[model samples]
Target: MRPVIPYLVSAGLFGLGVFGLLRRRNAVLLLMAVELMLNAVNLLLVTADTTVRAALPHSGQVFALFVIVLAAAEVGVGLAIVLRLFRLRADIDVDAIALTGPDATVALAATSPSLTSPTCGTPSATPGAAQ
Candidate 1:
């Protein structure tokens, strides 16, 4: 196979990740997008390590391992935050998040009716309304 194939696939995955990160409003989806981007980088790194004649043959693989570790840590922290937000507000829509001032929790509650209101999960106040 051509060396460029893996690079192109990696680029596509990175582009898809960026699109997902920008387009998604759910915190979990955003985290998944970040993981997608990290995997793309990992794929690129391993491909380079195997195909290129580098001074250190396993340098890219080592870096990819680091990225994997970082990605795992990131997922752990991100999920914790998401779970906390879900518990506090009963929702995980990122667009509804507005952490400002001393009354940060109240701010989100006041700004987004879908967050604290009775009709939160109903079609009357959809996640799109917060945006």
Candidate 2:
């Protein structure tokens, strides 16, 4: 069918975005992957609108418009959060924030000591504690 090409391309783009989102640790790269996923969905909606018989009164176009608005909002909020994080830590590595390892968790906890307690200091003898 004539619409198959666009649908396949959209699917591929969505898959690529998913892969990038999962594999990349950079905040900017993650945002780009999100954009790619949004574009892919837009393309699929437009293609469906054009190919389907008895056209459905431009509902797809309306949906696409809402998606664009949502994407813009997402980008704005996401960038603001990323900027704040960068200001605080000076880096944009998503993996760094995960802090899955015990060492990482302890190090983060030590660095961010409680405001009301001076005794909440760095771990003195924990093995593998981050420097």
Candidate 3:
């Protein structure tokens, strides 16, 4: 078996993961791309374990397992945040979500006066609030 084959495959997987990460704007798709990248790393680790005669047997596999655990945790937290954002904004497009900059500051100031500095921008009172 040619050891180079696994390396090539791992490199391809990593490249695809990077492309997905860069191109996708949906929050869910972004998480999936991160998972893909983690999986690529796992693949590389396992392949290297097979290729190299390390003193500690299966250390790479152990590390791969750790990566899987980390990925699972990340997905859980990420999905929770995405769900909350969806509930709040009714949209999941990452490009539409801006946490900083002028637009965000203005929007935030309009929604809640306490969230923005008094000098930052004029806060608009919501409907039903006492004038």
Residue pairs with colliding backbones in model 2 are: none
Candidate 3 worst ten-residue window by lDDT: 116-125
Tell me the tens digit of each residue's lDDT in model 1 across 1-131.
57799999999999999999999999999999999999999999989888874677798899999999999999999999999989777899998777775467556556556565333444344466755
**TM values, all candidates:** 0.78, 0.76, 0.80
Selected candidate, larger TM-score, 1 vs 3: 3
Q: lDDT tens string, model 3, 1-131?
A: 57788888888888998999999989999999899889989989988887774677898899999999999999999999999888766778898776877787665455554664546345445679887
- Deviation in angstroms for 70 in model 3? 0.6
Error of 3 at 93 (Å): 1.0
Query: After best superposition, candidate 1 residue 100: deviation in angstroms?
Result: 2.4
Maximum-TM-score candidate: 3
> Clash number for model 3?
0
lDDT of each: 0.86, 0.82, 0.83
